[model samples]
Target: MSGLREPYGRGADEAGFTLVEMIVALAVFSLLSVLLFHNVKFGVQAWRSGSARADELQRSVVTQELLRRLLGNAYPLIIKQEALQPRIDFEGGSEAVEFLSEAPVVSGGAGRYRFKLFVDRTRQQTDLVMTAAPELASAQDNSASRTLLVSDIDHAELAYFGAPSPGAPGRWNDSWEKQSDVPSLVRLRVSFHASDPRTWPDLVVALRVRADVSCVYDPITARCRGR
Candidate 1:
């Protein structure tokens, strides 16, 4: 009897878990799993937001740099026009004002840079094309000299602001084609949409086009020179 009772006591001690103990263990595990899942979800959201902000910042910087280079190098070119009617091609499929300048030091070459803004109907975006002028010798007769600089724009606009000549009123010129010479300052406005809305920068950039030696001087200076 003593031996049997000792064996029974051992068996009782090694018995399976009670209902209350099992329920408590399961509840603790479920709580821990919920906490871990929430932590992971929070981390993923933070990473995505951070990545989106970084991408937007990068795109803004790139767009500003390209705009600066193009506007800083603008120059005047003659436009072909008929006798009485004055017309100039500003953008879209029409001819554009050509400005020639040495490539930026970053480009590492003295190639000619041509800048033009054209609308891409298919893409529903504006494109800024930049091309390097062909070398004299290797240049092909049918080959175009220009290269693409930056594209994928929503819209690009040019506004002239400066001392308007005698008869003209101060206003935003939708097209700057009629001006025989480049204005003292040009206000460039660009708008675009980003794939990620949170990352898009305010789309406005104003640039002053560089002046050339051929630019007209003040009338006072001309009179003084005549004296």
Candidate 2:
């Protein structure tokens, strides 16, 4: 009798898991796998978003610096444009700006270049382009020499500020062509039409050399100023 009881007890102890136990184990494993995948997917998305934002920020900083340098060092290098009319080095408008400035030392352009920033609209979107040519060199067209400042713009505008008269009401104008001076301030506005999440803040840069519209008379002699 003790042998029979021992054998039966051993048989019972060696029995495999029931069907319900196998199903429960599989369900738990699947749930754990899904949770792990969810966490990993969330992490990857966060990393991508962070990377994109960082890239956009860096680009914005660079654009702002480029614009700053151009505006801050705007020089009034006078030269005869046509017959005897002395042309101003800086001419700005609502959608375009043309200026003669010293080229970046790093670039091959050592001396000066006529830089023009204008909007180029296409079927898809509008783009802000900077074109440069040798100052007064009279290049045919700057089509080959162009730099894209910002792309996919839905709208863009430019404004200039200069007092017409001393102690007069200073106002922003859509165009500026004094033929002898530059604007005191230049403002640029841009907005994108695409789905890009990044935005550009409006830029308003002040010139180091203030706008002078007074008669070009000698300070000491108060006589006719020579060109």
Candidate 3:
């Protein structure tokens, strides 16, 4: 009991930590705090990066679906001219395509409209645009509308395929120049930049109306297997 009392009497002096021990404890606590903060920061950054990539992917998917809808609804022929060979106003090139497309009634437009799809790439940026005008509209109609289908694309290409001539087979071409016929197939490819963090897949559309290839000299009306 006497020894216990002696130790208890010195409690005040032993209650506080020494200066060197305090400094060492503070240094250890600070190091642990720094490590925890850095770990949390890294986790937050990783989550942000993954979320941004997912968003970009979703946007690209929606854009692709819209494009497919337009291409799948491509109109075959607006009118056929008996006076001259039926020359469709539709033209498909390597970088652009112009043609007539059918619009849904639910979308507010009920009839066929002329549409043009083109890529605008400049200043290290890319945009996919669609311009539309009614069939009766002028070449430069003020009522024409434009829609931005996609952006941040690295490059894009358009290819068309159809019978090269009457009684011949179909083949892919960078340009569709058969004035009297429409291409049977259309393909689209888009590539994203390395740093864009977006992905683009190839799109291919088969037209509803296609040209008939097998034909012979017409014995009666002199039309070479027109469809």
Candidate 4:
């Protein structure tokens, strides 16, 4: 029985793991752990990046829609200074545009408002901003409220399309020179920094209410009158 290697003791197959076996097992486990951690980290990063891009795209859509509504409702508001000739309350330039529209940016109610859309530049970045006030308020009024439409913008360009004189063919102009008339169309071109991943399409809005229905136009004075 003694020569049979101790029949009651554990055999080689039934013994605990050896030092070399333990070391090899631990090494494999560590490698698998590292690979799993890296895969999880990459997945999280990709999700976050995708979420940010989706948010940016949504913001762009909302901003573009807002601009379209405001510019499409352009109203030909006639402003009469004390004892002066009546003029249309609209100013169009390459970098800025001012006009009266039926849409209200803040109130979201039924009323006419004067809006000034321009680009505000700072040391850090540039933004497209709009100032809104009541239609009766002057441009210098302090009651105007400012809203930021687009952030980190490269530039904003505005173009006007209108005729120079009565019965003349309308053409696109960098700046609107006729203060007594409203442009038939307003073109808004906004660009972001090259590093920005967001993009917006060019917005072209037609003025639905370009002339006052209640007023008669005077061909001689080039003004609207209650004829």
Candidate 5:
């Protein structure tokens, strides 16, 4: 009986951890789990933020490219009031402005391309519109064409910089008017929303207009300029 009792006492001593030791182990595990979870959450948030930034950059680049192409290919046109109706005509009675490089083969099928900027009253957004000229018929009668580019703009403004008219002083006009005639330069200002306001381009693009013999205007030597 004494030998058995001695073995039982030794076994009880070695049996298990005390309550305090168990509590300490559990506390350490909880701390480790919390730290690990926080780190993982932070990493996920950072990754999502980075992805959003990349997407915004890509959108900005695309918008800039589209603006550059349209402005680069722009041709000056005179908007006049004929019989109290607005009519658009080329500065020199030349061919209508072409937005796309290729003319569709079908007669009246596709329209001559032109770029315009306007606000969408319904959506309360600014947009760039591309339209085909009606007078210039393509292969088919369905020549009227219109497309919207880059919507959700906060603000967009177009300015004309050049001599107002012959015998008139050179000046800059905030909104294009008929008296402005053929502007030497067209300035485009656009602002859009993004996750990071600082990252937004808030772009300003300047396009040179072709000179007309009647206007005696040279974009290179034009006294008017945009800010």
Candidate 6:
């Protein structure tokens, strides 16, 4: 009987895990799982944040380029009013700017257009908008189109750089006063709310065409005589 071994059964090494050992193993596995989950979550969040920033940057660049093209193609066109004095079709103010432009924001429509850029404010949001109308629109013509340029703006200011009169000292003015001539330079400054992430660089554009280049100035009428 002593020589004969016990029935074939579990040995000490074959006992399998104890309750405490099993608990410890489970704890270790749970800890590792938690750590891995957090790492994956953090990586995903970072990727999303980076993508959002890149999209915002791209949108800002496109907006700036569009503004540059529109402002750079400003035209010096003169419009004659019925029984009124002829004006150079350029008007600038502190909060708004209107002028004749050779380039239209919307494609396909080709001739000269009257462009107006201004800020629209509401309780929910503030936006910078552009309004375009036909250059030869009659007084009764109410056909005009509006386009939203940028949103969430605090303010938009426009200034003109030129002399009030010919041969006078040039200076920056809040508004363009001379109706017969166009300003030499136009400046646009836009700002956003403190909470907004977007920023705008100041845009200063020089007028390409001179209003009096091929025209004769009539001091008597304070206007350009020839087109």
Which candidate number maximizes TM-score?
A: 4
Q: What is the per-residue lDDT of model 3 for residues 1-227, given as tens digits with 9 covering 90 to 100?
A: 65555656488768889899999999999999999999999999999999988888888788777777777767656334456566665788888998877764444777668789999878868888888877667776798788887877778899988776788778888988546777878899888778766667788887775533233334355444342
Worst lDDT window (10 residues) for model 5? 92-101
Which digits, one per residue and each the tens of the lDDT, describe model 4 over residues 150-169? 99889989998888567889
TM-scores across all candidates?
Answer: 0.59, 0.79, 0.79, 0.82, 0.60, 0.77
Candidate 1 C-alpha lDDT tens digits along 48-167: 998977876786677667656665565443333335332221221232334444455555656544444443344455565544443232435544445443356565555555334546
Candidate 4: worst-modelled 10 consecutive residues by lDDT: 218-227
Candidate 6: what lDDT? 0.78
Candidate ranking under lDDT, highest first, comes to 4, 6, 3, 2, 5, 1
Runs in model 6 lying further than 4 Å from the true structure: 1-8, 12-15, 80-86, 103-109, 138-143, 212-227
lDDT, candidate 5, 1-227, per-residue tens:
65555655777777888899999999999999999999999999999988987886787687677666555545444333334432223221111123222233443435335333444435565555545444334556665666565556665556656665568776666644444334555555656666425244444445445532233323554322220
- Give the higher-TM-score candidate: 3 or 6: 3
lDDT per model vs. reference: 0.50, 0.76, 0.76, 0.82, 0.51, 0.78
* Reference-based TM-score, model 5: 0.60
**Cα lDDT for residue 223, model 4?**
52
Pairs of colliding residues, candidate 6: none
lDDT of 6 by residue, 115-147 (tens): 888888899988888888776677578878888
Return whichever of 4 and 6 wins on lDDT: 4
Clashes in each model (backbone N, CA, C under 3 Å)?
A: 4, 0, 0, 0, 10, 0
RMSD of 3: 5.9
Quality of model 4 by C-alpha lDDT? 0.82
lDDT at residue 122 of model 1 (Cα atoms): 48
